[model samples]
Target: MTTAEEIIAHLRSLRNQRNIDGMRRFGIAPTGEQLGIAAPVLRAIAREHRRDHELALALWSSGIHEARGLATLVEDPRQVTRGQAERWVRDCDNWAATDALAFLLDRTPFAEEKAHAWSTRKAEFVKRAAFSIMAGMAVHRKELPDSVFLGFLPVIARESTDERNFVRKAVNWALRQIGKRNARLLGAAIAQGVKIQRLDSRAARWIAADALRELRSRR
Candidate 1:
């Protein structure tokens, strides 16, 4: 039972001011006691305490940005719950943390449910998590039938109008990933992309054009 404090203490030792400054230039704003640790280092730490659910929870409660990212890595998907997912997502203040949470949450049993629930969320990071999870699932969840992703096409189309940079990028990621999954979904995602292209919003057209470019080239 490695304690969260001990791990966070270790994280503090690995902090890099250069890394922190570099991350900020890419829109990864500092949030809550960030230690300026690189992601690969955190991932290595998580591997050390893999599947430590209690430790993950405690780290998350600490409200340290990198600790929260490490929490996502160390958590057991089997132990994750809807309540925890909601709580952690609401804590996400940056795109990096949001993507870390999405990467882990996408492996949970209730990922699809949370994806839909969070997609319509008012919070920018929360909404980004929804599609980030969707994008991850498309790449990794092979056992899930195509119908699951097919159902997601409409949601992707609907959300394409979001003008926020993070949300639109994630929406495009989800669409492109789904189209790459299989021939059937490729056709479906492409059609959805074309429909999205017709939407009045600038964000929608950008999302559609980017997704359609890759998806069409693949066809």
Candidate 2:
């Protein structure tokens, strides 16, 4: 069994001050220890571990930023319980980590339920996690009906008023990804964007414009 401590020790060896600085410059700061490992390298490490759910849980409990990301990569989504998801999501300190968790979370059975649940949160990263899961689902969950995503549009619009950079960007990402799924969704998303544009918020207008730009280009 590959131990979490062993992986963390190896991750310690891979630290680069330059990479850490670069990540901080781009607002990727985590609330805890972060080894300056690039994401590609972490993904490679995850490939080595594969779907070791126990190892993933151990890695996540370590509280190191990159280890949490690696945990998301190597964990078995089938093994993800609602309690585990809730616990891990509270640990997200930055957009990058939030998105990493969201990608893994969207693969789980309770993804849509969580997406709707988290969007109502007041915490910035937590709220952003909702749309992050939604965006991930748009790309990966093809079996889902268009109406599933359609239900998310109102939530996206509601969140568009959040001026937080991370939250609004994720709102735009979800809208854009859902729109790109197919022509039917594209039309609905475009209409939702127009409605979002009508809102009295700078964030809403920006989200509308950015999504509309790319969505229209797809037409």
Candidate 3:
């Protein structure tokens, strides 16, 4: 068998049904197969096979939760294509996989373009990926100017009424991360959050309230 097949076999061998139950409790139910291995173990495995783009593709095709997470770690961000990112985002079913993929995609060249494009999408996970990319970029892309994130504020406000658990949480995450970036952005983010609170939606209120609390605390 190939190295990818061998690694997948090893992952399956480490499956823990108890851990699977715990993961489900945390809303990480993958639509495909899962071994229920914890993230640290998957990261360790990925470290052993770093920068294996082909292997990452094969593992993603395996449709196992842990393997997909591993793919995010092992794949070369520079080698990732916009088409590939779109395809992977479409396959995401759980927050764990979606967020993991977003983290990887955030490091790619197409991140900013896709983040804006996908944010407007109506699909739950796709939209979640878009904001997840924003959140990841807020933390990771230090060179980006505040204007980029400020531009996203309108998108967050528009989507605040979505009411989907994943989408709302991700929107809040993006707002909070951008706010925490600096003093100036903190004020801007808080102002946006306050505006979001008045939007007449339960999800918007929650996002605004939570972001305000965190942004204020950092002041």
Candidate 4:
């Protein structure tokens, strides 16, 4: 068994100060220990270890940015509980960590429920997680019906006025991903974007314009 300490040490060995600086430049200011390791490298390391629910929990508890990311990759979706998802989401301080965690959570059965619940949160990152999870589901969960995503459009429109950079970007991402899912969804998303365009807020207009452009281009 690869111990969490051993994994942490290995991650340290792979750290690059330049990458850490680069990450900071990109706004990935991890709240805990940030090794500055690139995501692809961490993903390759995760592929080696595969699923280890316990190890994933330990890694996440370590508060190392890359370790938490690795935890998401190695976590067994079946073992992921709603409580664990909620706990980890509250710890998210950056887009990279939040998006990675959301992607992992999207694989769990609790995804849809959490997506709607978290989007209503006032915290910047928590609300972003909601839309991030929706984007992940749109990309990965092929079995989900169009209605599942369509139901999210109203939430997207309602939250489109959120002027936070992370929140609005995520809202746009979810809208675009959902629209790209299929022809039916594409039409629905475009219509929703048009409605969002009618809103007075700058954020809503931006979200609507961007989503409509992409959704229309895909048609």
Model 3: residues >4 Å from true position, as ranges?
Answer: none
Tens-place lDDT per residue, model 1, 4-114, is: 889888888888888888888999984688778888888888788899899999999999889999999989999998999998899899999999999999899999999
Worst 10 residues of 1 by lDDT: 30-39
Model 1: per-residue Cα lDDT at residue 106: 89
lDDT of 3 by residue, 1-219 (tens): 249889998999999999999999999999799888999899888888888899999999988899999999999998898889989999999999999999999988889899899989999999999999999999999999989889888888999899999999999999999998899889999999999999999999999999999999988
Predicted candidate 2 versus true structure: per-residue lDDT over 1-219, tens digit per residue: 778999999999999989999999999999899888999999999999988999999999999989999999999999999999999999899999999999999999999999999999999999999999999999999899998899999999988999999999999999999999999999999999999999999999999999999999999
lDDT of 2: 0.95
- As a whole number from 0 to 100, the lDDT of residue 182 in candidate 1 is 96
TM-score computed on alpha carbons, candidate 4: 0.99
Query: What's the C-alpha lDDT at position 205 in model 1?
Result: 98
Worst 10 residues of 2 by lDDT: 1-10
Tens-digit lDDT string for candidate 4 (175-194): 99999999999999999999
* Candidate 4 deviant stretches above 4 angstroms: none
Candidate 2 all-Cα RMSD: 0.7
Rank by lDDT, highest first.
2, 4, 3, 1
How many clashes show up in model 2? 0
Clashes per prediction?
Answer: 0, 0, 0, 0
